[model samples]
Target chain A: MTDLTRLTIAEAREKLRAREISSSELTGAFLDAIETANPHLNAYVKVTPEKAREMAKASDERLAKGEGGELEGIPLGIKDLFATEGVHTQACSHILDRFEPRYESTVTANLWADGAVMLGKLNMDEFAMGSSNETSYYGQVVNPWKKEGSNQALVPGGSSGGSAAAVAARLCMGATATDTGGSIRQPAAFTGTVGIKPTYGRCSRWGTVAFASSLDQAGPIAHTVRDSAILLKSMASVDPKDTTSVDRPVPNYEDAIGRSVKGLKIGIPSEYRVEGMPAAIDELWQRGIEWLKDAGAEIVELSLPHTKYALPAYYIVAPAEASSNLARYDGVRYGLRESGKDIIDMYENTRAAGFGDEVKRRVLIGTYVLSAGYYDAYYLKAQKVRTLIKRDFDIAWADGVDAILTPTTPDAAFAPGEITDPVTMYLNDVFTVTVNMAGLPGISVPAGLSESGLPLGLQLIGKPFEEETLFQLGQVIEDAAGRFQPQEWWAS
Target chain B: MSVDIDTVKRVARLARIKVSDQEAERMTGELNGILQFVEQLGEVDISGVEPMTSVVEQTMKKRQDKVTDGNKAGDIVANAPVSEDNFFVVPKVVE
Candidate 1:
């Protein structure tokens, strides 16, 4: 009741380690908060307090032995997209609403091994196809921050809306997030929290329900840049279970935080300074540049000439892969089986009834783009543009730019349902999608607030496996921000 | 750009979704809007642009052409809705 809400994982860990609190005590605070706030926020799809309490008791016992993994005693809100053994991981769709897996995803298992308590699964866009959480079958997520005297509900950003809203509201300290194209960063930006999409293959995806097999990467969303870095470090492990997961050694991300950014070069791509971008975003970006300059870092103007093509290319590639990846859900092996007299009827009936409108749209687009007659026109063309987008970044990075900084979303989070057409909504990821396509690392740090009191986010994209630089730049940008996105949801 | 509602119906069939006639008509308009939006990219001449897959400039690792999945017949059929004598039960394809 004393607003134990906004405390970071480190703060909670320190409190517990000092015997000032127990893991049960910390978990109780969040459990209480979830009960009090979840109906209003829809941040959590499920809450396993008994399971959480058991984990907390074990963590407290572990602390009694002076042994702690990096994330010990931490209560994490997992995106429902990850499979949890015996827990319903529906990917926020009715099709999988009853589909509880018998196996846990590598990421969730690793976090559990690191001693993190499961606060239960958070909501996500249905199959993570939409940029805004509104597409979720469970319902839309409201932004934790509301303008004074206005009853207009705002978006918490999507497809990780529930994760962002929960973390922003302090219902959980950190939530696991996945990004194929800005699912993590866009929601983080909308909620005024920190979210990172690590280099592709940084985290194992064996149990994750796939959206785009070629592009999906999972990371963490939390209250601070350092906390995001810590959570990311624990979640990433090279797993033999995931064929696409690279066997790269995980780096010491915690050590990289608070490092000086003196003499670091930040690239400012003029192309990203899009026309009609909100003025508040511009001011926040300029402030970020000034922060770097004040820290003895140099700013350079660069051009990613193929920037305009990224959004189109991503639409083609993401949907194409999503179509194929989702082909597994055809009422056969597992999940929401529909009984029909004939085999073909069973597959069609289950899928047609199971999937929502947005999911169906992606499946159609995906099939169309990959079809024999049109594959060369759409999918192949997009692949070519994808190459140019990558080359554009290669040229800039090769030009001696250490990292590129841009507004994570071209605009701050919008009022829920303001976007009617889906493509306009998909365009929201114009800035963040390129990084996922390039298999590079990008982090969204809160820059400041807009005049309307919504959070503005500055995205820092680093070269492949250059997460340390992202953390470094993120810290500098955080200092310049000076204002936390209004997270009033916790106090209430 | 003449639009065709029949193509939308065909797409829904291929996607295995039973879209109502009304929904198909609506989808035709929406799909056209998306195609128009994406058509903006065609303005930029990618005349000789090379298609690239994997965003990372590095090459993907190739797996040996060995069979790692052939022996899992029992496991593959474990979740089958209908199975008979270790074989997945599908409706007879031809008479």
Candidate 2:
């Protein structure tokens, strides 16, 4: 009984199997924690306490029969972006007000097949658009970690902010999150947890709300590297429903934990040392290099020459695709609708009223880039730039680089309203976006604390479908840095 | 490369989003700021590079073109704002 909420998913699984604890007890503990913490953190948009209890009871039955799934009885948070059957699946956008899918997403279906219980839908940036969680219609998810001795609230870095903050605050053992750019990794870094954006096609995008379709991917955010590895094994699979989902068999990722990094080549790109990055981040990056080197990883100084262009080009490509993907919300089939004099007018009114400011800006930017006059200058050019960006990684991998190491974000978590400009906010993904751009796997492992006492994370970028390698390397970093947890100020 | 207010309005119309004169003006500045940021892409040399069609390297998977899923009309319109007879109701398009 030492705070059942504090047990990692791995520990809880063992305890549940041994009958030392029941899934009902574990689920109840998480529900109580969420009820206490959610008011202050705003991490959960919807809590399925009844459903969770029912699921836990079912899991207890399965466990008693010794026939439970991999994640049997383990409670987790689901980002609002994923469609949960008959549950709130808003993607934190008012556009989908009170909308619930009749069917489940393949990823969530996969988790349930492995017996994971859904605690609730976690809050996120509207349409998964912002770097900070402020863009969410439910309001920002406050970071569980605070600056040393400071009472000022900090943002849990976003789109997946609720997932990270919930895990860090022990609201849930792990949470499902999607990454388009750095949604999963950056928030995990900010909240002192482990999150991985498995390669683009690793998890089916069937039920997840579309952001930038090509860049969007689903992954897990958990308390420890091992927990993340365990969750991912159940989450990733080849699905025929999504054409982009690769046909390869999903590997047992847990086996990669504690795997030696001997003879591995860790690439440290010169370009990621961006101008105006705080000295502490650079120092942390250096420490990561030394840690990997100590673990027998050969460090190599290399260059991703087109690194500078990746973000600018991403702004164009992502928004362009987002504009197209989001065009489905025309007040016709589902969600919010604003009546107008005519069909065209209705479409206009609905979208204008439905989408948040950040979403609108991106949609407009997307429209402008794909417009007839500017298509060649913007969209096509950005695509070509994307080619070069991917080529940079392709070359590195061809040269025998096992993985690339960098800081997860330019800095640690900041106050909610500190950043207002869109372009400035987009820079938060600088170190992490290239992985999504190249369709490669990446993991962010909490590494150390910033000078301000907020948590910082080091990221590992791996070859396509090489998430096992990232897990192996991420465990090395986690082993060196140790786990970080925020002081429980909210419950009191 | 900056978008003028008129162009912003046009783009808003094209995107089927209503923006007032004031919102469009504000968006003009914001869009210009982002356009200026992305203008840096012009510096990259793309001599003979082809625009990437897909990020992953794979041939498109083909499935047998047969009737597999249907008969869930009620489920399809489960969240529709207005629906009847298993069909989504929208504002009349044809005059």
Candidate 3:
């Protein structure tokens, strides 16, 4: 039999429906793969073997009864950010040590309802704060893809690093990931996988650990474009629990996979061609435009004048919101708590010991921005620039642009500790934060190999609630570039 | 506009996260580096642009006000570090 672990969600679905493979067998294959690859990759923080078997058994019964959910019997890794009932739901932060929620996050609940089996909780940056997975308290998640012949350990871009690496290494068919300032797209770009950050509120935030409430969104990372589409259809829904979740129906995203992109106006933002962008990334971006053009997408040159200010504004607004949201972890309720002389001292000590450096830095920055004296200059000013950034895209859309295309990251994956300065790390989100700023949807499609044979991706940003368009365009790029997989370095 | 150790200390106090003199010193330089980078926002002419509180424009979603949830204090306190009578226990603040 073909390797069960190698099947895409769509391919697995067909085989299971045809009775060529049982859910138990498929789930077991993935469990075996995880047992072998997880130690080296550090992708999974907690593996739920018993829960997976139980879920797969249920799925087999459903399949036997000729009734199964869209993702019946498929195994997927859950990013530790989501609260899984009675399961580990720490956001890879010391603050959430050993915490497990009784209630399931709405996104994970939706997946389980579709009969997807839980593989494990994937690792991520503490509080989903950093660009590289190095901020994870569980230690950095190593990217499965290494540079050409060097055995140097590269970072899986984060805070969705584990999800990206797991899917890349075929430890899971697909994985749930979140994005706040490019967590999903940047990591997906780094690991040769497909990741989409649906429009804000496309999926419920009821159970996912809050990062920056306004910018945080849940989506999927998958090995194939169609797999991402399939996973997203099951993951997205309107929930009464999350008032921000839109009341629109979740469309069958798989239908968009082969949809025609002919005559589609794909805007290429001139501002994205920033100074000092790596030559290989530039060449990949040019190749992306040619691929789209060949597939009949009309590439139009455009300018987002406020693009340069996006990173600056994002740092302010995200931190401000993060400081507010993270205040709930005061050592009174769930998670870690350190002893102190009194209540005030306890709060301080608990937080000081609990949060990692990046999380602390962000929380402090958040508090600083929202402070009485600096609120107007930093927080309020950044909010105003956020408006201008969103308006830039609105203006382009008014000019009949169906979707905007750009390089996913400034460069491909970098080795751990390669970029130490926070400012340099912040630049990883330069090409992606604008999509979040505008509440638009974006997807990263692995498009080309770098000079060192590492994968690079191109992003397609779509209008609000128009993920279908991104999937269509992403498939075009995917079909053109073909799929990329790192050789079995971890397993070996 | 630069973040000095004093600024880091003050911000840490406000955020309720304790930091020592050494961490604060290191943080001062790091925070200043970020502040210097974000200060570029000053270059943009955002005159008269309304501050966007949220990208998705929506009003407060209203539903018929009634008891919709609750009655699960056990579940709520299940993950608490310390609990008593299904209530989260915290360090005593009262005299």
Chain A TM-score values, per prediction: 0.97, 0.99, 0.99
- CAPRI rating of model 2: high
Model 2 stretches astray by more than 4 angstroms: none
Candidate 1 C-alpha lDDT tens digits along A81-102: 9988878798999777566776
Candidate with the greatest DockQ versus the true structure: 2
Provide chain B TM-scores across all predictions. 0.74, 0.94, 0.91
Candidate 1 wrongly placed segments (more than 4 Å) = A1-3, A483-492, B1-3, B57-95
Per-candidate TM-score against the hidden true structure: 0.94, 0.99, 0.99
TM-score of chain A of 3: 0.99
Pick by DockQ: 1 or 3, better one: 3
Per-residue accuracy of model 3 over A354-446 as CA lDDT, tens digit each:
999999999999999999889999999999999999999999999999999999999999999899999999999999999888889999999
Rank list by lDDT: 2, 3, 1
Backbone clashes in model 2, listed as residue pairs: none
- At residue A259, give the lDDT of candidate 3: 90
Fnat for the candidates in order: 0.48, 0.89, 0.90
Residue pairs in candidate 3 whose N, alpha carbon or C atoms collide under 3 angstroms: none
